[model samples]
Target: MPALPRPAAGPGSRYTARASTTRPRPARHTDVAALSRHLTTRDLWLARMLHEHRVLTTHQVASLAYTSLRSAQRRLRTLHQHAVLDSFRPLTQTGSAPEHYTLGPAGAAVLAAHAGCDLADLGWRPSHTGRIAYSPSLGHDLGVNELLARLAARSRTTPEAGLPVWLSERSCARRWGDIVRPDAYAHWRDGDQTLPFFLEYDTGSQPLSRVEAKLAGYAAFTTATSTRPALLVHTRTASRDQALRRRLAAPARELSLNIATSSADFTTSSPWGPWWSPLGPGDTRRTTLTSLAARWTPLGSAADLEPTDADTALTLPVPPLPPTPDAGT
Candidate 1:
């Protein structure tokens, strides 16, 4: 027989596959029944979080779930050993990079079983971890997760503050891709105040004009859905923050979009603090996220977060924070 032509090289060629550095999958078998024997409620929740967010770092997972980094690392390593979670450490220019985690095959099985659905319903593939490990948007995804994880972590100490609903980019896109695709959508509750906002985690990679243009979609989404959630544009640097504020001010006002801008520097202390600067002439003072609800009283009538009939049953929203642990686990 004539020699078969070498497999055509394209997107899935060996050359492209070499980019990922994820640890090898465990050779040992992992099944849902076996997992049930030892997996705790927190482990299941972490699997759901990894499934929803795509990826999270060791530090981010620690902030969101564990009491300390040591505990988080220990449990995470256990999960990794059992193949409930897969991890990869990326090469860094200086110090080492934290191990970034994604849902493994066993995790997807557990999630699907818990949700009363098939593996296909989970929308995960064998290539999921490798894809995320080598994705170009890995840094951006981590940044978004870091900010939200901080908000979730804050609830641990501040009993009055909580993030009830946090939807990842995929979830947001499913709901509003036709109108506007926000980086994430969340409901921030502080005492008696609740603010629902769409986040735009800017990394200073795109032109300011392109960033400003996103307001048009938000404006349309508001009109189409008759809901007016706040739009928060968080930039990597203060200079980018100011530039975005200036560039977006006119259009935001023109569209009557409730928009705000903040930088990483200001948010390092506490994102829930007075770090957000609204767009408008002479509106220079930063304000808290809860206060923004007061600033735009109309948000009271804009609480339309409930899933609609059009949403796929598989894509229902998940609580940002895991369920509170029982008295003893």
Candidate 2:
């Protein structure tokens, strides 16, 4: 039998009726049902991370959410397809970069449900996620999240280490914008002790002078808050580190700011080790996290940050603090 050739121009044809190339997002009720049935505890964690951090890459998702890249990819793809997640791939000079995931419509609904709030309360707009790709600070934003992620990863591996309290740029801006918009705010605690710090992360894409400009704000904030937190400066290159140190010298002395500079390092034992160079005169050896308070007396007490629970808390890997801080590679 000859193939049917009389189906052209049919008004009621099912297959040829301007076949929709776009996949429509699921309805709210459909998404909620799917969430209840298909979502896992880890999936919820991943959504929280995306919601808090704004974005995360495949490798970052793997490190923070899954035990392996294959698992992360498989799960992420499924989530992306099912409208439980959304992603965008940025173009790089070398090629394209890893797709960055943010909260999707369904994911926002899921988060809101989990938090027992309305979708609007999640503070999520699809436009926000879409606009991130075009933002000038996209690299800087991802870099900030990456730094925190690395710290969170370290905390998970090192039992003695304590997870830090992370506040996003928006949160920092909301909390203390009068002082200076910090890249982020973090408080690291070991047992009962907590030492909060202001984070100034540079991706090496901006000029060193810009970094110098931000220090004055931190200095002023420290002066006003009566809280001298370690202003940890994480940069991409050693040159940037040195330049930053030199630039910070005046502020450190004049404002009595406890500043430390270190090259952005994600390797094991790098951040907690003596990679931090205190930005001041006399015995400028690299210092550890706990030693920062001692080196800079204004940064409160060192005894508070030491893990003194004397329990197995230091013997096992624990989840990062403040619930969910974002991460990206």
Candidate 3:
């Protein structure tokens, strides 16, 4: 075997050898920076992208991180090894082979802990795909699911209600025709008149322009019906301020709408139920005092509220009760 040359030593290297002459060699300590150096900016960006999208493939994360797919894959493995991420799975896209990558629970927890950090703040922008849903069925179901449930319940209650509960109805336009599906429609005979009601339930975060368009549809349908009422019930996860309340309630009231909006009355049971009735706005006060008293009453103490002769003397005259299910607006 050929002899190999040894490394030349410098003055600094001699200090370690002369142990008594110099300070005893300190014990090797962990390099904190080295421990975290594997986590590059690309890895962080990938994690943030997954957090925003709620799901991502290796290719997708790579594209966001501005790195090669393989580099992105290696980074994910490192992250998994460091307990920063859990694991990944295969996801198939049309016209492409299966791609495997996803943020594990650990990854999600980290991302969520710092969710307020925005890519826009970091000078990054994602392409606007304008994709409605991953699947056509999903979009259809999301748009029509709750409406269908209400209709199904109505059908079970009144099988002969003559409600047209179609999934897809086509509409014609000059340039582009669209499939328009009104969520539910029911018709009933009222004093020799066939009355119809069109129902729509919107539950997603939607644009104001889209909201106006839906309102326009409801207006048109209501105008076309024999003697029907158009009902729109929109539930949202976000808070609706009083300004929004006034804006939403104004049109319905002006147009003689039976519209109702859920307000911030979280104390009442069925917090999201019909809190206000636009049709009977005056009747709102009827139950206010009674509701408060009922809430304060102890359980199993219905007998405790027996009115005395003095209580009858102090009673104020209440308005006559309206027959039928009044909105008590």
Candidate 4:
């Protein structure tokens, strides 16, 4: 890391100028020449995450990537000044919320160079990004990312259970076309069992009928294929989970599609724990990610999956909510 110049000493230091008498010269920010050297591996990783997820709250980024809010803020401010990151805070009923961050030109350029690809292929388009601040799907988008972040955090601690693969919606589109748009696709690892599944996250803004309509497509897609990964539905509340489970069981059995349902508000428990239940009212026994193969028998015969040990990491600990950020423009 390059050494940062020290601040001026006392009230009348050389680095400081009395605003009334003299205009302070903005100390030269990191120039384009030093950008690649200035960015650490962690910095690149942060930019990659921002690119993949699109929008993330300061609190979310800080919690996931930094040890403290102060450090995250310091780096973010520097990155912003260098045009490496762009941010905007949304207006809310209670004043405003934590500012969100996205990849800026400098950061995107660096990623493009590292990947040996053009900015377009790297998913950088400021024109497209500018319109996301007020998009109606913003809440739902962040909600899906929140679930993935939690899973990522859990994977770090519970090696026995890992998220080996996670594909964004855009990537899923390229892989599966418009047949069925899952919010994300993942391969979850539990001991020896590997479960490939699709995630459908609901933000409580849609009607139950609309959600059921999506399941109909999933059922059709599964029925048309020989090997089908399980479908996991995560809702905002337990009540919604129960309702969706009942609705899903009919199609899953009728079409023989494997499915599991859970609520994102399982506040006190780790999502990796037995937070999921197979789609049936009669069998309400909680199941783990790895055990889904066993719980939903169809998933096993779909491939060479074998019965693995129980997900020993039951009750994954949910971290405290990310620290709030200061007011931003």
What are the per-model C-alpha RMSD values against the true structure? 9.2, 10.5, 26.3, 9.3
Please give me the total number of clashing residue pairs in predicted model 1: 0
Query: Residue 124 in model 3: shift from native, Å?
Result: 40
lDDT of 3 by residue, 1-329 (tens): 11111114322222222211222222432232343343444444445433333334454444333235555555554454443433323234654432333344344444434444333432222221112223333333333432332332332334443223222211111101232244433332222233333334444455544644455555544455323343434344325423334456656555554443333232123221234333234443212212322322221210112345533211211111111221111
TM-score of each: 0.88, 0.75, 0.31, 0.74
Per-residue C-alpha lDDT of model 1 across residues 188-270, encoded as one tens digit per residue = 88988888899999999999878977889998888888888899899999998988888898898899988888999999768
Give the C-alpha lDDT of model 3: 0.34
Against the hidden true structure, what lDDT does model 1 obtain?
0.78
Candidate 3, residue 288: the lDDT equals 23
Q: Write the per-residue lDDT of candidate 2 for residues 237-301, one digit (tens) a residue.
A: 78777887887788677876777778865323346667878877666788776676555554552
Best by TM-score: 1
- Model 2 worst lDDT run, 10 consecutive residues: 11-20
Worst 10 residues of 1 by lDDT: 11-20
Question: Candidates 2 and 3: which is better by TM-score?
Answer: 2
Q: Which ten residues in a row have the lowest lDDT in candidate 4?
A: 311-320
Q: lDDT tens digits, residues 1-329, model 4?
A: 44223224421223221221132223553454477776655666667667666777766777566667766666665565565676767668985577677787777887777766677877678664566787898888888777766665555466576665666776566545557788987777777777878898877777877887887777666666656788888888999888787766776677666678888767224677788888753476777877776565556222222223521111111222222223221
Q: Considering only N, C-alpha and C atoms within 3 Å, which residue pairs clash in candidate 4?
A: 270-316
**Which pairs clash in model 2?**
none
